[model samples]
Target chain A: MEVHSSTAGAAAPPLSPGDFRELFDSVDAFLFDCDGVIWKGDKLIDGVSQTLDFLRSKGKKLVFVTNNSTKSRKEFAKKFGSLGISVSEDEIFSSSFAAAMYLKVNDFPLDKKVYVIGGEGIIDELQLAGYTGLGGPEDGKKTAEWKSNCLFEHDKSVGAVVVGLDPFINYYKLQYGTLCIRENPGCLFIATNQDAVGHMTDLQEWPGAGCMVAAICGSTQKEPIVVGKPSTFMMEFLLKKFQIDCPRMCMVGDRLDSDILFGQNAGCKTLLVLSGVTTLSALQDPANDIQPDYYTNKVSDFLDLLGA
Target chain B: MEVHSSTAGAAAPPLSPGDFRELFDSVDAFLFDCDGVIWKGDKLIDGVSQTLDFLRSKGKKLVFVTNNSTKSRKEFAKKFGSLGISVSEDEIFSSSFAAAMYLKVNDFPLDKKVYVIGGEGIIDELQLAGYTGLGGPEDGKKTAEWKSNCLFEHDKSVGAVVVGLDPFINYYKLQYGTLCIRENPGCLFIATNQDAVGHMTDLQEWPGAGCMVAAICGSTQKEPIVVGKPSTFMMEFLLKKFQIDCPRMCMVGDRLDSDILFGQNAGCKTLLVLSGVTTLSALQDPANDIQPDYYTNKVSDFLDLLGA
Candidate 1:
């Protein structure tokens, strides 16, 4: 399956009524990034549920792909239901799940334990994939002394260190992760996504997973194998699981780097939405490298463009 | 004043009796890095006290320079005394002091307070320099919830966010520093040094100031004004305060990048000591770009070479 559109990463046109019909027919599935597309923090975007219902009513496949490793698929499903959206847990492909899938695809030894510098989402996904994860919320309260006579211990069985959005980032986890990656033979360093900041709250942006990953990167002097969007790993997982061809899919997201870039990497058509982190000027600027095939105001704009 | 040494960063010759005599006569003052050179984590290097006495007997100016931002100059002086070395607090130049001096040299507004993501050393030094330091130990116990409804407030008076080694590092401090650096107008992002590992304990190496600084760098999407060794800021402060010229000083240290490069950057003759983090093979490796004028097993070798 290959990209069917000629306007790949070019100055995109706004989705017209005719273009919406063309997109509706050309793509058999739509992969939407959840944070900015489906909702913003805990609040649902306007007309999001109705638009999702419209796509589902037309027999189009919808996958909610998100880089937020904070919550599990079950939690996301719960969030969707709470926001009055009808979505199953199986429709989500979070970065935490992607990380677990990455390990599974790599044939990671089941006997070796994986150390995590993330949240419970990563822990749940790893356990669901038959891997034991250590150092998540359990290590949240753990700290290394500034200057002490005591020595810290690291598990010898730690085969990998997976980093994500860890609010519990502390000195002990940093030291432990560093020791594991540096000292453990063949220890893999994996990162969910290097997002600079997150729409953590309704009012403000907070430090994202990149800060945590960068800390470990500095200490270990090693770059991690990024297993999230823009890497094509998630695309591969989605491809195998859903058995959907890239040519039949359209990717919708607010972030140009992770979403549009991931779509481009996966040989799928991409639509950039301005409802989240991006602005009109940012997309129009020639300095911006990543461009989508089509752009609109929001995910709900598809319905408005078609005069629903 | 220019360095008169013929072999600069070349295949450095070992410090022999003849070479020691030449170096002793040529340089008026000696600058020693504390951690790996003078001692290794609370224990004084062998004959280090004797070497200092010998240098004092020969009328050589002695100064202790350390990139550790964890302790104040007074604390370092006490550590030196406890280890059987009588060094004045004023003779010590720590990175924490350099950070405070950097603000003074840069003419930072006196009324603007500085936010710290480090230890009491930075706080003490900033206080000593008449700058109010917030968010060091005060924010150490503070934490941001994984998902919270409360909004975090950043001090509008914060004109700089200085980062160092903080064992008590958490998300709240990271967020606060990020806000201060990103939200405040003309807010300075200062880092003591980007040292990768700290010799925190006698048994093993721990994550360094670079980890903490890198975290802030990731969040703010900004580079810091490094104030420690290899930056020449500390060198400039030392020169102006001690009334010593770089050409008349011999810099002896362990690490190649911070210590040796610092000496070379300042146009001072350098002596590499293998008693710390660097190995002789590491120094001999032609792939290594940084080289000192002379190499020795340790700081005490100066006395051994001269048969003191």
Candidate 2:
């Protein structure tokens, strides 16, 4: 493996197996990004499950923090179980859950509902937080071809519009969500995440929740309060929920813009793993603003420090 | 009526009935925006038919330029017929037709087809221009929930991705369009227009083509070549097709941003009609960049100019 001496005067260097001892000693909790660091698609990276178990054995707090808001925390936990990782819903903090908690903590009006432009995950979380609203696959409909004088019957009880990744997104959902935010006075606009694109596999990537969020923003000319990685909202949510000690926490991930930047914004040490979207060359590039605290070939490389 | 004295150091004033004679004598061709200038919703505004007839009696060339790309020129002509206005399909210049002409003039490969993310209008125009492709309501489908390892079968013959307003847009359309642009090397991206918000009525508005365009742009991080009002592309197309004298042409419209700006860009005199979106206060606002050469209450107000 080519070793990259970190530029930009940050002194970040490729962590040797011997350096793992200092990393383990420095952090009490570990936050991980899912897609690249742990697994790619349905298959887990080699030795990830064992490394996670080793971290747990070392009394390090393990938490899965993902910007993917298409699935609820329970669903994510189920996926983890399927992957042979024993994880509770409490240990999985998805952007959907962050949005729900944000609304609940803000004391969202019980009389008002959140107009959602997302999938079942966002709906389930909003329901769990006791917020009612319209959205999901059931709300999908073909919109009228032309603008007509016929008045549309809108749900006046809608107080917020929450957007996330929606595979079943249609014109009606966008139209109705736009209407709620534009017509309804003081209607809060929020997005579960702002991931520009979602990597499905090495050969496939699609528009993520950020695309849907941008559609609404383009139409309404209003920027939403984004609540996901890279934004401090999700980090703040995780910090308060897990009671994490800032200096003793480390975020480990594959992407520089979201995962590594998120860790830096959250006041935690960050470890960059080369198992996902970002490469060592990307980190070494002077144009990139965010840099992780350390770098490794993969998450399983930490096994060397454990003498496994 | 509140008269607006043009603020940007350009001398523009609301034309009085006496000034109408000189305005009519100055221009040989009349170009008009369909929606707020000629008709509002399904009903025609007062004196429009009479004013149009009066212009024809004076041997003035008539043309309709609209940003709405939902219908073909034939369809627009039919709508004009329904409104008692005598218009030929050749006289109508729509964004869809302009897109088709653009591809045709650029000598788009006959073997390749355009991947559309719009309605039948764009499809019809492309077909008329001898370009084959996919899009319209038939392509609307809910994409698979997760990105799978199963290879996505993409049409290799697609050379361009054209986006416009689509009422039946779904995830699969967005996914396929994104894949075509990102996966295919040198695939052209085009948008018919970028209208931010489409007004249905005073109380109802929906996300326009710009929203869908933004979704695709957000995913691919690629900006499209726009070909509609306010973008000089359509104006250049009209100028080439009709071979009209720019100084002898006058553009009449309701919106200052699209129609008026388009006329100014095409080197034509512009007249703003208050029958649609723009109000007198908006014209007087110092913040607006584009200004028309003259102002009138409505399109039919030109009847007084012809002494009808």
Candidate 3:
């Protein structure tokens, strides 16, 4: 519970991982959160390219883990390239991708229709993974129509629950989602991510796909196996992709709760950047106790510490 | 788990000393939620007053238990009187009043300023209970400026954490609110209720007073002693005020979760009316599984049952 505040030029590694160690020290792979850390709404964060190059020089692997299931891996790759960062579809792990992998690996009948409650990203990902997407009832006043037609009537024909971001997600949809899961307990309850929301501009603000997932989760009292950040699913995917163990890894991010806590929980050293949801004043406040192993002002500050 | 949908009619008993006899055949003092059961948006339901008088003539006691902490018992009496119903202030059990009573009786000390994060209702109630209503930091931009003047200062003069229906509540207020309670664990954490939000024009609105309570409760991981409807606080208030015991009571309401569940938990027979949050459709939906001992189309039907 001791507050760690250091403003020295470079200090000894007194507390395990010190302030001035290489930002990517002893790390074989790196996991980054896409929206806030790498780019915030249409604009890329400064030094992301140079930092990637520096990590590439050190032979470190990079994987972008995003809870934004509304976009597929291909879509992410294209978006990343558009932002001047070179990335492959294989180098990304989205909750949708994880959900697809979960379904594929389990050998669940892929030809069946999935009652989706998300956008084009989820639809593309699931289809690419070899599953049919389900549409809601025609009348659509209540999801009860979908319940009778898509779910209950066909037992094993319903492949999985591919819940993603849909703004029109309402209580009736929530009711049907629960009803489907409750009806077929063996039917997979897969969520792309459990993130309640992502902050966009005020006018276009929308509840992330996770809010719908959570509402159903709340009703059923069931914890879905989350695939996105902070969940070990993405970390495992990244580790397997890079062929690295937990010790030889470091997690860098701006948010403390999900990003830093993810690193801490996964036994990796964490770097907290004060460029996003968390700030320096928040950490210094006596009330909050979420402290990271190392503190850097932004992702760009990694260069000063690493001397790359 | 059998669904009970019997309303006041041919099969139901006329208003007797125990309205619960037709259902549970046991129970005493009746607890009623005022917001939705007796009225909706300030409009009294049919047969509400006549039903109350009939029950009174049968020697059954009743208390108005409400989660709305803004108004005092006197205020409630006036509101009820305007609606052509005679309500004594002493017969009303308000969570705000209960919280104030708890603070006063425990000698928790009104020596410090109580930071308020609710509507004028809760603030006025706190004032009536002999506590100073303190506001948060008048300034925002500078954290240092915030530390000195904000109600969450790490000082001894702060009395407790009081929260209620605050439409203006945001991240900044929550951040400071979290700080205040964390800094002083002994500082009383009093909430108006735990409903995330209540009804508005459309959409599942924030359950007023209850939402902030839930937020703080989630953050601190400490459940506050709820004083509103469905709590023993209201039950005890009724017993003390009306000089009655539990065995001879019943409860009438529209929503099963709040009103009926309150009665069920409080050991009284519950009547569910289909005029508010929980409709007959919701109850019949299998997923909900909420069934009151008796069901009525509107609040007025209870008068017919009472033979008023």
For candidate 3, give the lDDT of residue B226: 64
lDDT of 2 by residue, B217-306 (tens): 877778989888877777666677678777678899887877887787777878999888777887888777677888989987776655
Evaluated with lDDT, which candidate comes out highest?
1
The sequence of per-residue lDDT tens digits that candidate 2 reaches over residues A257-287 is: 7787777777778899988877778788887
Given candidate 3, what's the lDDT at residue A233? 61
Global local distance difference test of model 1 = 0.87
Residue B40 local lDDT, model 1: 68
For each model in turn, which proportion of the native inter-chain contacts is also found?
0.63, 0.63, 0.00
Give the least accurate 10-residue stretch of model 3 chain A, judged by summed lDDT. Answer: A143-152
Clashing pairs in 1: none
Worst 10 residues of 2 chain B by lDDT: B1-10
lDDT of 1 by residue, A1-308 (tens): 34334664478888888888888899989999987777777877899999999999989999988999987788888888999988888788899998998899899999999999999999999999999999998999986764456668899999999999899899999999999998899999999998777767656778989899999988887999998887788877687778988978899998888888888878888899988777889898988867788899999888887777
TM-score of chain B of 3: 0.76
Backbone clashes in candidate 1 total 0
Chain A (candidate 2) TM-score to true chain A: 0.91
Clashing residue pairs found in predicted model 2:
none
Instruction: Please compute DockQ, using alpha carbons, for every candidate against the native two-chain complex.
Output: 0.58, 0.51, 0.06
* Residue lDDT tens for model 1, B60-158: 999988999989998888888788888998789999999999999889888999999998999999999999999999998997753546678889999
Q: Identify the candidate with maximal TM-score.
A: 1
TM-score of chain B of each: 0.94, 0.90, 0.76
- On a 0 to 100 scale, what is the lDDT of residue A27 in model 2? 87
